[model samples]
Target chain A: YREFYQCDVDVIGSKSQVNELELVQIVDKVFGLLDVNVLVKINNRKVLTGFAEICGFPDKVVDITVAIDKLDKIGLESVEEEMREKGLTDGAIAVIEQILKLSGSTSEKLASMRSLMNGGSASGLVSETGLKGLDELEELFGLIDAAGVKCPVEIDLSLARGLNYYTGAIFEVKAVDFQIGSICGGGRYDNLTGIFGLPDMSGVGISFGADRIYDVLKGLDKFPKSLASSTTLLFACMGAEELRYVLPVAAALRSEGVSVEVYPEPSKLKKQFDYAEKKSIPFLSINGGNEAEAGTIQLKNLTTGEQKSFSKADISGMKAFMNM
Target chain B: YREFYQCDVDVIGSKSQVNELELVQIVDKVFGLLDVNVLVKINNRKVLTGFAEICGFPDKVVDITVAIDKLDKIGLESVEEEMREKGLTDGAIAVIEQILKLSGSTSEKLASMRSLMNGGSASGLVSETGLKGLDELEELFGLIDAAGVKCPVEIDLSLARGLNYYTGAIFEVKAVDFQIGSICGGGRYDNLTGIFGLPDMSGVGISFGADRIYDVLKGLDKFPKSLASSTTLLFACMGAEELRYVLPVAAALRSEGVSVEVYPEPSKLKKQFDYAEKKSIPFLSINGGNEAEAGTIQLKNLTTGEQKSFSKADISGMKAFMNM
Candidate 1:
């Protein structure tokens, strides 16, 4: 079997659209932390249901959404052709094209869709389900704005998420500047637990491709430099005597949450320093015979080339200095 | 397919006994963090080989060790019976029993076995390979003692690890007080990568069963109470107006590394507090109309029944207070 790994977050219970809004906030927070600019395309399935009804072929909702889902790949004309081949009339195809192509902010676009679904179009269409979808979108977008979600969000009418089995808000996230497919997506399911025997439990969830996110970070060079080193400091091994002296100090620093690596064997100071440098360790502690006799530690900031001395027993002070 | 998960750690490119020492230290550190008392059993395959030679059946090493490996479940008389059935002379079986049953400290046991294997017994046998194994074990144990591994370390003679494919420094870890299977085990392999075409590389490694460790932790009630709560603080949602008031404050606290959850919908004060209590959220932030007007937050520590007020914009101070 083909295998890969993806992180999934699922929230169970509650019919409140606030879960949807919170999911959008999660997308916003995640991308914000990763320094990735994103655009969240959101739509509701009820709106698509109303769209199918208004277009005079409610039974063909799956066909229409599946075709529309390919708009980015096959273009509008080909999507229309696909819909035409799926038994939709020219008039219905035109209505699909017009509504999905409506250009505005998420709120403005929902308003336009609401007007069209309310018989503003020449087809004299009116759909309560579609209007409800519009209302949900309006309220969700309001919550997102009030929460100050950082990413740009849009109402993409054609983003039916490929006939996804969602009953409420649908979400798809893409990196704004990266040339890749959707990095994250999820939607609301009216009966997420029905297959396992419980019914009518509404829930929303999202999953992001970890590999794509890693690629985006790598391609854009956004990974932190600190990640290159696992050890925050390296204590140079002078000999058995020095190792004994620094053993407790290293343990103290470790307990204080600093990752300290003590060189296992005595080696040339130059060799030890090179080992620390190659590993990108930020600090180096040297305890030779002199330091051992003097009962002090000679610490050097590898990055800044700053040197300082500390009492051998001042574990907390040494830790604080390294943190600084 | 049956499936499970275990974390594996492998260290490559070192032939020094220190690698074995480090692996033991890792076991010590992991169990130390888990608060489990464990005994680390260490042995070497070469030593087993030498024992077979000293037992007068150099060609029957696998059979002798295999029979001895079952000593725990099958008892000594049955093991000797099985060995005799496999063409081991009764004298050899007696020798195997004598050496494996040496009752002493690890060092004392090794010393007794060293004298016996050096032509002290009636078999008048000596094994260079077995001597090297003992030497390697001596160095590794010395390093472990010097490095001050916290867990008890022992040398086990009958620990053949079931015909395991290891070359040196075998290890198995068991909880001292828990009646469960071994939680961790591993050993050194002389040519780990030779199967994939890279040859002659030496490595020491260990794998601990995550499920078994979890079971031990759970059965012993060692899991931390802090693992129960994810949200550090829950803001009581009084209404849309109050939610808006706490939105930025929650964001600020979240940016300061505090987990902040804003109740999604307005509800009665008791209901909101019940939600916080159910989720184990320690801190509850209430910013009702009065607090909103006063530009302050009414924060209560649910666990301690302590209340404090902070200026709405002082996120750091609020974070520090929550941390305290």
Candidate 2:
């Protein structure tokens, strides 16, 4: 439900190297943070349009592309069957099957596409639109190489993204180690806002499927340990009077950027200690009549079971002791 | 859209001092951060129920409460009119008006409610349920005082929250200086999930109206300046070769927790610097043929307009220079 409209020409140009590198860098940083292997598959919608022209069904481009997008889930035969059901001729289906079977290094696939668009084997189907698509792909690959993106990428010719609004390059990211579908995707759209009466503004952006990414991370057990808890210290008082005495200390610690909580009412010692344990709080500050009257606080390292007493005035020292 | 099931009795108990203190502490911290004056109004649905019983129309409690919730928006006369239309007696409406007009300091209002419930002047309306509700309110106020909650509070008997599900304490937070509706509110719901077949579970929670809070902050110009841009550095290279050379440097900076971007296709110096300016990137690193051959980088501070050269190995120093 979130949308970004970028009208900056340098970054939103359909085939700009600046846009490509920025995207690759983002992919690199995201995967680097997740510590997950990913493959960034890229293709151009123009190429698909040219492909439909060469299939002799330029008018049925949307129908063909929609069916082709389900190839991954339904298999090639099912896609071919669906296209045929959509009124595509046997010749068009065969041409699509040949394109789907394309596999090799990115450059090798680009070369194959170039030959196909040059009318080397397919005559009367190659068009200037098809050639232009190949040229854009070649330039994109060159910039990707110059940018030195670490993630593996391929010129996935069969990747026909479902949306019909994309007018140029399309990008999709897949987790290499997980079976979840594309975790991120977006593409260039020339004049997407034109339909809203603001014409000639082009833009491109990517959206991470956050829920699916969460699922992937959870399934892989890749979440970082630091996200476990927000509370770091608990004040375990012994009585109502002790609680009142500890309130200012808790407030001071909180102001010093330490997450601190005071047990509201004095309960059983075991129950208070168990509360600290269950919350995984690393430090516990306890104060009773004796400590309160002495103007001091008893600090206990919950993890180490070490206890010490500090003067209440030594707030800075207590913060350092608790590593706040 | 978020649902939390709290089965722990200690934290979820509606009358528990621990739970009340925790909520008050949280409210204090949040309002402290927002730096806005707020009034935290508290009432118990049980108290409203008692009010209905005292009005001699226990069965019409829901109808009366719903109408009372719109008191602020439609004034007292309209509320009385609506109640009359809903079949309340003229005597009952007059009594309700007396209750609604009872307003003063929180303690003074609580005293007035006690006398009213004790049948001082309006006799034979007080019930055991009403007494119990008053006792709970007294205990909650005592706990709030001990917890040292900083926000102002009021005991307005007319404050009937709209929801019928709240069985105990209801809280509504309002910004004193802003015209927006409640910025946050929540209440205790007893056995809400019992309809789904699980019984005897109680929970209480508060939800901050984040969108309204954001609007308030924007209108007040209270957002921190650091939120303007996430990127701190931009590497402006001279060519594809320079981009390749700067890629690792950018990666290293990113690994060190600095947000950095490199000019993708090495355009004019002016264009790259313009990109940096537009993005609000504070630092720009330029390494052309001379600096590249010397294994050095020219860093420009966009904010201070200070330019200096640093050895390529001084990445740690560069990070320190940018205060990242």
Candidate 3:
């Protein structure tokens, strides 16, 4: 099996707008450069918690949420069965089923939730957290709308990311064309630091699933050619002296932003050509005894088998030709 | 623990100067953009294989290699025991041990290996493939010399990446200041596609250990400041009608690349101010009936508690202020 690596950028110690904006902006810039279109969906746990409280399911909050979060994966029936198995009252399960089934524009869904909760002993149990959650949603959407970022920002209440530490906005980005699970996801966990004995600190961050993205990009053949290049030229030498003589010329080209490499051994020209062909190297520099003595180099195009001789002191045109 | 992502890019089919050069170039660009200095090391397995064959223990090649590969992790004693356990003769083990201890520049090490391997049953057994490896190494170094790339690239035989697929060049990059493991590493594997029924197709690749790099960057506080932004401004409203008036203006500023958010409720000004403070929003827009009708906004700087009035059309300046 192959293993990949990850790099997580996070903001901890505050749940302020600056922290959230900062994280999202970085996400935007990094992925933006990679030319991936992403839909960033955000939600808050307090909203879900409030929905639970208002549904007369205060005690079964975790159980109800944990099951409902799997709505997309296991479907509604399994979630309801899970709720029933978790000892939720029939009324509570019924309400949860209704909530889980609730879908519409985000505002419409919230409106429906509000109407459902506007009843019984659970009235107003959606309480401050849920109400604040609703307000936060409105504000967040307002911010997103106001930002006019090209990437779609959706308010997804059902996006109950499985983690227990999320307190405020939870974010996940999905590529429009790929579906190997989320390409990037993260959230604001207000109490993660509490585990380390530092309470009440909040943090938000995202992890880009690099391996999966790589697979996705590779499968789609989306890697930019520029990202895969090593060198633009290779020097095929016939001897150590030739290699030594041509080193400075290659060095000068390299200093001028051309990537140059010289073959170390004085091997057969065909063998050197084989090496160049296999690595996808585009250009080959041939500087045998004659070329060395004349202070000239023959640049051969590995791809097209084209060759041109260049004076040692002036190879700018050759550099451009090699780049192509 | 936080997780980042990693991707390994490999190219197989040819072990030439082009392939090795491409490897180094890709390494330079990616790591260069990331502002990470890496030590790219190259090694040839053919040399090691030559040592194994000339040691009179050709059958124990894999065992010898596997043991020696663990030298950095478990030390020489463990490798010796591993060879002993694999039934290598004492004489062969001594020969292998002597070759393993070869030190100095790469050519010097190669010289020593050749000296030890000469006059044995395996004499001249290290022919074309082995010689080709040395030639490849020289070509690789020649290319690197020619390129004059700023990143440090070295040749070390001890870096036997634990795999048999490598037919030509192998590479590993280690970050100097980080306490973590190899930040990046990969090599040319000639037979990777052989498992997929495409033998002899050589491929070279490198993988960046993004997660470890992220940890190191985070630990070093190397993240740029702009990455942590959330909303640029919070539009505090006097009432529902006031919010309606602010929406279009918010949208306009958003269109101009400013992240603007509006309060959902007509909360007290103090409460709104506290919210702005909590969110770390630097600017707040307060639209009273007068300002709303006048098509102007009263902008309050939360950090300095400074207020300024701007006409609706003048909001594009927010983008410049934030990005600049």
- Global lDDT of each model? 0.83, 0.76, 0.71
Worst-scoring 10-residue span by lDDT in model 2 chain A: A1-10
Model 2, which residues run further than 4 Å from truth?
A1-230, A234-251, A260-302, A309-323, B1-17, B55-104, B124-127, B236-238, B245-249, B266-324
Please state every model's RMSD to the true fold in angstroms.
5.3, 8.3, 11.8
Residue pairs in steric clash, candidate 2? Answer: none
Please say which candidate is ahead in lDDT: 2 or 3.
Answer: 2
RMSD (Cα, Å) of candidate 3? 11.8
Q: Measured against the native two-chain assembly using Cα atoms, what DockQ does each of the candidate structures obtain, in the order listed?
A: 0.23, 0.19, 0.10
Worst 10 residues of 2 chain B by lDDT: B1-10
Top candidate (lDDT): 1
Residue range B133-189, candidate 2, lDDT tens digits: 777787778767755678887665555555577777777778888878777777777
For every model shown, what is its TM-score relative to the native structure? 0.78, 0.63, 0.54
**TM-scores of the candidates, chain A only:** 0.90, 0.80, 0.86
Lowest lDDT block of 10, candidate 3 chain A: A118-127
lDDT by residue (A1-324, candidate 2, tens digit) is 253332222255333555765776687778778898899988888888877888888888788778877888899899999999999889888777777777788888888777766664343478568788788778777766754678888877656665587777788889999998888887778888788887887777777777777878988889875566567888986876777678777777777788887775678889889988887878888888999899998899998888889998788888888875
